[model samples]
Target: TPLRKWEDVERTVSLAAKELPVTDMHTHLFSADFKEQLLWGVDELLIYHYLTAEYFRYSELSYDDFWKYSKQQQAELIWQELFVKRSPVSEAASGVLTAFRRLGLDTSSRDINIYREAWKNRTASEQIDKVLAAARVKEVVMTNDPLDRSEREVWLHQGNTDTRFLGALRIDALLLNWTVASAELAAMGYQVEGEWNDGVSGEVRRFLKEWSAKVGALYIAASLPGDVRFGGRDHLTAMLEEAVIPVCLELGLPLGLMIGVRRQVNPSLKLAGDMSMKADLQLLEAVAVSHPDLQLLITVLARENQHELTVLSRKFRNITLFGCWWFLHTESMIQELTRFRTELLGFSYIPQHSDCRVLEQLINKWEHSRTVISEVLVSKYKRVYESGWLLSEEDIVRDLNEWFGGRFAVVRQNAAKTKVR
Candidate 1:
């Protein structure tokens, strides 16, 4: 079933990349059961953190006054400034246009009300299904934080009801904000103090165990700032070593680390205020070696970290590099990273994860991503084909699937098979 010509390679790779059903390995999406937590609609798309950050870049509106507006009002200003006053040329702005077109909504109207009216009759579930299907997203993993009172309330009270949603236990609080963490843990009936103790460790382990099962979490994750060092001087190191690592090791869950985020550089920007700094990639060297059996999936926000991160993944068998996160999620970065990842790592690394907060944003994110990635694939395939290699449609599809989510599954499977210690 080998394809003979360059034309076939171009044609088949494009279609396969576009049509393949992918798993979003990391997203903020909730099930329809969580109600408004499952973000969608044109308003949510317009007011996305990316667009909001860009909106404030040029808008004369003061931060306090802008925060005073309703979500719809904010979305309206964003639409007018980003879409009307200027061209919707920024990635996030153009993504709004892309999502609209993919959903079969009228982007040509340039009218926010038209998009809003189109969403009036649709249920969250309907919109989720349409969005996922449009993106060819088969499944999505959610960031579930037990220390978050609202999320924990939903988890403990009603729990997630949607079949498509899976969970990853987010331990940002456990890693960084132990004050709030211990208070939340205490309320959940786990007796722990402001410090990590034997009893406290046991309690924390118990919490992780119960909640991981409660939410069907596939892994444990935390977002750490650039200064956080894995084996060196850092406050979170002890908690990670004593609590998070052991629990993850015992439960056969891969530890997901999203590093290099420097939070609240501009408090006025809220979620958009955070920025990236070059993390000491050497920090991971010790942890990756010490816990050789445990799976470590990492993504960094700094562009400077990409080369070192990929190089370090080369040194360790257990490390799996994934995603072009945050500021690095643009199309150009995706292409650049995809090129090197393929050249150096071959197909071992995951090319991208939507990191999508809005459910409907999946449509445009993947729509744009597929186009960018497939272009890389076409060139790579041609080079290999010229080198006397021929690929069939099945081969291309399988490769695309692996880059999308199959590789992450293999990592998860390896961790699952690890004898929990």
Candidate 2:
């Protein structure tokens, strides 16, 4: 039916955005097959890096003291500090409440054990189902690291049971810290060495190819610093030029570059310790110039780099910007990013990735994202509608499809001809 009225267009956009099953291109989420590696439940949600970072902002707890406590004790401390002493109003705290309400837990009771009791009888499989359903996420790509011993054991030995989870080969360690990654690769019986040579490249490529096939990797991924560049001293640039890009071309996978991450700025915070910087855009321009056919999935962590990233996307069909990654995943950032990303790129960009580390995070992440995206769509539709373009329900659905999932497929494997096998 035609969306003749402004109200009708608003309804259409909201419904489409809400019901659309998101294709989360990057998540630290694992299937139930990962066993203990898969983090879920209320305690896990409370102690997540984001909340832990927030917990430190107000509490007088020392990093050493926090580290000494168990996950349960940490969660209880976070609950008392972040939720009880203050309001559960911060986005991270709000996410926990959102997940609780969706899971049918009585958040009004304000007790941590009540939340735990709700999750008591629920098995892993049930948790996955309920969370995915609540999030309306049809597919999620897991960050698969072959060098990580525990995850490696699961992939090579136990095997992944959930078809809903696809793999993206994480190569930051391989690219940035080759000495450490190479030693592990050598230990695993891959003939990889620290020196950069044709033989070394071939061995690294062979390892990537083997693992890409093992996990059916949809793409290769890396998180790099703002200072990343081509023709550099670092192994990162060399690995991309030699093994990473070549293997990507061979296996029909894109390189998802999550740039500008300055790892461990506050060493005490551990995973939450990282920060972002304005990456030199020339790095991407150089790679895009060199390999026109190699699809590049890009996301910039710093707000300073967003406009330049969007403009770069304009120049290269090979480059597709995705997600408001890391610090930029909040509601305001999503609103600002999605608005300009739409105004500048039209429907060419992939809107957002969940980047979720826990199972239930999918609920709050997508819920917040869908709300923000729907507003953007409605306003865009209204502008064209008032211009006598005469929008329809079909138009909103079609664009929403591309915005959420369709564009990912096109950008990911369309350039390369072969499957990873």
Candidate 3:
């Protein structure tokens, strides 16, 4: 698997078991630059030096190639299905009608007659069909929002290629980015409760009820702000409560909330390229959306150190928290990375970091911790804890010792303070 053209298999295996042995087919296989090229369909010779080496019969596919091919194939399939299914606009019209009724608007004969006439006159369904047909069907998730005249055009063109392919790969879970309030999300039938400014009100509970009926599995992204009235934090607890209502009552829906994080504005790091770490931490702590069954993603950019990574790892369970570091060839790492970004960030907005090492390390550590807890501890405990399954006093000491490795311990309360000249 390591030598297979695509590293995804190797990565996937690694994620499945934290102790899985990993061997690189070639050193170049780990190179970010080469991986990028491989993604763009690079040649074998460029991928492996042995192909260019004298007297060596080069095997065509490496692990990376197979993975890349798999991606392309899956993307094409999703495109095909999306085109074939052609989700009807009548669903949307029906939803709007229902909403009108909830909002106290009459759905009587007069209103129905007017609506019927408008529906007949409007070519909304036909327009949606046309947009899907015209989509270019690129096999990549847009790095940024793309310009498309019609909403349907954007969905067809920009649907999560990465997520679709990963799901096809049969990973445990996939993270996705979305704003519940966005029109696309609404079309997907995610109900919006009370206004964000109003905190989590009865309306939010109603929205979750509607959403749960439709989506058997749910992930909600959320964040908190310092301001009590309007920020995500105020409503997040309510949101989670809403999610569990149906799940607990045996409504047949399994719900998860990937409490999203948003960076707070900070000016101290003016030259530090976005010093929003503290703000992100605040959001994580204030509205801790930790649950044993649910997968929570903590999405934040690293500030070029392991400090933030260590702190986050110590907190939160069922968390796929992403820092700036990761193993490109590990599935668990990739999955965690995606969870942090998509599941958590889908609701929360954390800016991307440019540094590779910090990002990569974040990924590795997150994968390591998640694998240990989910694969091992969660089953053993079979019950949730406010602060994760108990770590022994010895375990705590060991972790602390590791944290302060080789750093001097205090000498009997430091006897007396010495004045510095």
Best by lDDT: 2
Worst 10 contiguous positions by lDDT, candidate 1: 227-236
Residue-by-residue lDDT tens digits, candidate 1, 247-271:
8878888999998999999999998
- Write out the backbone clash pairs for model 1: none
C-alpha RMSD values across all candidates:
1.3, 1.3, 23.8
Per-prediction TM-score, please?
0.98, 0.98, 0.28
Better candidate number, 2 or 3, judged by lDDT? 2
State the local distance difference test value for candidate 1: 0.87
Which digits, one per residue and each the tens of the lDDT, describe model 2 over residues 142-177?
Answer: 999989999999987878879998988998889888
